[model samples]
Target: MGRRGEHSKSEIECMALEAAEAIIEGEGFDALSARKVASAIGYTVGSLYFVFRNLDELIQRINGRTLDQLYAGLIEALSDCRHPQQCIYALGGGYLAFAARHPHRWRMIFEQQPRDDNLSIEIYQEKMDRLYELMEIQLKALAACPEEEVFIATRALWSGLQGVASMTIGRKPDREEEQWAQKLSRHLIGHYLAGLGTTQFNSRVNQSVGRLIDCPK
Candidate 1:
């Protein structure tokens, strides 16, 4: 007989995540299903449902879990750097590395689209606020920049990360893409640090964010 698995519910959730990640890595999210996850972990589909009300909830949970991991890694990457510019730079590099290391999990977060007033949306907003707080701290440390400038620059910095991460996780980026991602990440951060080319940068980023929210809901 096969060996028994971990007994705790949380442990099963973790295992489920592991299975989900494998599915993502192998075939992308479009191919994911409870049966696949259940087969991966030797659990039945009913057993999986006992933990997740539906696939959306399971995906949301996975997104939340992976985002926290990404946040922790980025924080660790920036901890040793003193200058805010360096912190932001390290943040971009760490962000790319994390995405590469856990491509499917990273993609899920990048592609998530939660419905308004959903519990998962609330959770997502809370996490977003925390990330924004980190950006605020970094901005506060640099240039004595005004609140408006910081908001503009922060959006640029984050959107650039998202853009680069998406390329890396796409259908096999070429060598130029790999090299350009590094160059692009650094150049993008530098662009923001260089005053976003003007205070107007914030308004521009806001408009763009408002128009093109491809990153799920």
Candidate 2:
């Protein structure tokens, strides 16, 4: 963010981006506007237009900041874990805790889907991939499955975990929720990894019976 001997355009843009994120955190996206942002940072609305063409561009800046923070948290969580099991647990806990602390930021990351030009969906999915890569590497050490399957399963597991996390943040907080949240989330993550260790579901169903009424034999 430093340039030669003075403040660069990049530095100004970074300030605007951070300001926008703060605005979103203070009030929902509906409350976000060029004028509001400018007022918050003691800049005129025209100044914001210099860095961003419109509100959408500002939103993109917010998304980039969100991803940057998410990646940092993930790296820090996995920094000390030597075993894959510990790494996986840290990833899950870190993700949930992040959502809990920054509910608005979490939604800002996923609410509006990013454009698929230079930054394809794969780019966003890459974040999930990095997290799952740890699990897959560990799985390969003990399992005999194809890499593609592992990737797909890991994605599904993350989707499930993200679902619970986002829901917990969006829904009103409940004191009774304390009874099941930790156990439920942990069970979801454990089963996801444990699912990779096996291939059979051991379903006990009457195949002979169908979804039909017995009108006539």
Candidate 3:
């Protein structure tokens, strides 16, 4: 075990977070505890308290890191896709793959309710918005809809993907299950995009008809 002063405060904090993640990933979030994390890092529980205000803060930090990782995975999924629609599919595939790979961490992101501090809430919202922004960009490009429509579509598509994952992904999802989830995601995206295109087309036609009716004749 390392002495308390051997590692700087920041290093201790990083070590604790990594240890906590490993515990959660291996044994699930319910298995996480300060003492376990501390022991894993060759430090005392008091050492963890020194760097984190409480266990809640530590969990929040983990959630933040998970979000950043998820965002990066989604970005990587977009690399080979040139079209906006293709990018959206890639995003859905990436999301499901991440959830399947890190089932416990992914579940913790939604299931764990962090303490409601303003700073924490702000930070969480910013991280969530970054993910939503990825979908919004693709939706706007593909749908060519109003900003309000694009926003709604972004959330709607994500909600659908989340639902698909929740229903299909398991604690240790197999390749077959993962493939099934991907299939559902593609179906959902295909139909949703088709409906969006139809809606926009009908709205444009209605506006044109209204304009013609009101013109001087």
Q: State the lDDT of candidate 3 residue by residue for 113-135, as single tens digits.
A: 67667647955899999999999
Estimate, for each residue in 1-217, the C-alpha lDDT of model 1 and write its tens digit: 1223545667767898888977887787888898998888887888787777777778887788777888898888888999777888888888877776776677777576655348577558777767766776776676445577667667767887888778654544455555667788888788656643343345447655321111111
Which 10-residue window of candidate 2 scores lowest in summed lDDT?
208-217
Model 3, TM vs. native = 0.91
lDDT of each: 0.71, 0.63, 0.86
TM-scores for all candidates: the values are: 0.78, 0.75, 0.91
Query: Would you list the rank order by lDDT, best first?
Result: 3, 1, 2
Q: Which ten residues in a row have the lowest lDDT in candidate 3?
A: 208-217
Candidate 1 lDDT (Cα, 0 to 1):
0.71
Per lDDT, the best of the predicted structures is 3
Model 2 scores a TM of: 0.75
RMSD, candidate 1, Å: 8.1
**How do the residues 103-159 of candidate 2 rate in per-residue lDDT, one tens digit apiece?**
677787778555644453534656645656755665554344466666666667678
